[model samples]
Target: MAENEPWQDPRLPEDARLTSLEKRLKQAQLEDAARSGRNDKASHKGRSQGMRILSDLVGIPFGSALIGWLIDGWLGTRPWVMLALLFLGFGIAVRNVLWIARQRPE
Candidate 1:
């Protein structure tokens, strides 16, 4: 009700409220980072590397197996071609994973 009290102003704009919230959220994040003593950049890098490796490990063989199955069906060779392609895919996946693991972290 007082003229000097901005806190009691019911007609404050939405943008002002959003800006205040953003500032407080940023402050809280800074405080949390200070308390945790962890490097977010390093963790993010590690997480990305792990995700890349995982995708390669899963995707390469699965894709190769699917292709091999299709080829076997077309050629009427049953499981032989599929098995060979699957093993080839597995070897390639292992080699890629090993290469990724050996790379120096940037």
Candidate 2:
């Protein structure tokens, strides 16, 4: 682009050439920013999605187990409900993880 500059034309005054160069510089900076902004947006989007998946994978099981334990204590069922719900929660977490993996972008 610099090699193809009209700023080198002999008819153009020095001020005109300077202004053209400044404009080109500003344009180049804007292009750079545009490219970086796209990359940053993609990166942030992927990161946030990963964090959400991680939270779901961890949270659901723990919440399920806690509820199961509380229910068992209230019903005097001891370990049965807790064990069943613990496995159920684990299955749900695995299902969610697999779903997320399957739906990921290529």
Candidate 3:
């Protein structure tokens, strides 16, 4: 053969070349899937954090006061139970906010 006639290495057979190409394709697909999964996980985490913050901001006091009022109304009690539960709920909400803040990435 000529010195520069598109020198072809005969060490690798056609089947070997095809197999190598297939492996490379599989690796590329797996890498893409892993990257996509990471992005999805990050988005899910962010959404969950936002929801937790919103719930803590709105749910605790409302839920506690509502529960207290319902219980008092059913049992014929008055402001005592309502006040206690409202304070309890407020405390719990503050605790949750602190916890969430501490858990955030710096």
Q: Say which candidate scores most in lDDT.
A: 1
TM for candidate 1 is 0.63
Find the candidate with the highest TM-score and give its number: 1
Off by over 4 Å in 1: 1-38
Runs with alpha carbons beyond 4 Å of true place in candidate 3: 1-44
- Which lDDT value does model 1 have at 34? 85
lDDT of 1 at 7: 77
Give the worst 10-residue stretch by lDDT in candidate 3.
1-10
Model 3 scores a C-alpha lDDT of 0.80
Record all residue pairs in model 3 with backbone atoms less than 3 Å apart, i.e. clashing.
Answer: none
**23-60 per-residue lDDT for model 1 (tens digits):** 99999999998898666786787788899899988998
How do these models rank on TM-score, best leading?
1, 2, 3
User: Residue by residue across 8-91, what tens digits does model 2's lDDT show?
Assistant: 777645576668999999999889979866545667667777886898788988998999999999999988998899889989
Give the winner by TM-score: 2 or 3: 2
Look at candidate 1 and tell me the lDDT of residue 37.
65
- Which is superior by lDDT, 1 or 3? 1
- lDDT (CA) per prediction: 0.84, 0.81, 0.80
lDDT score for residue 72 of model 1: 97
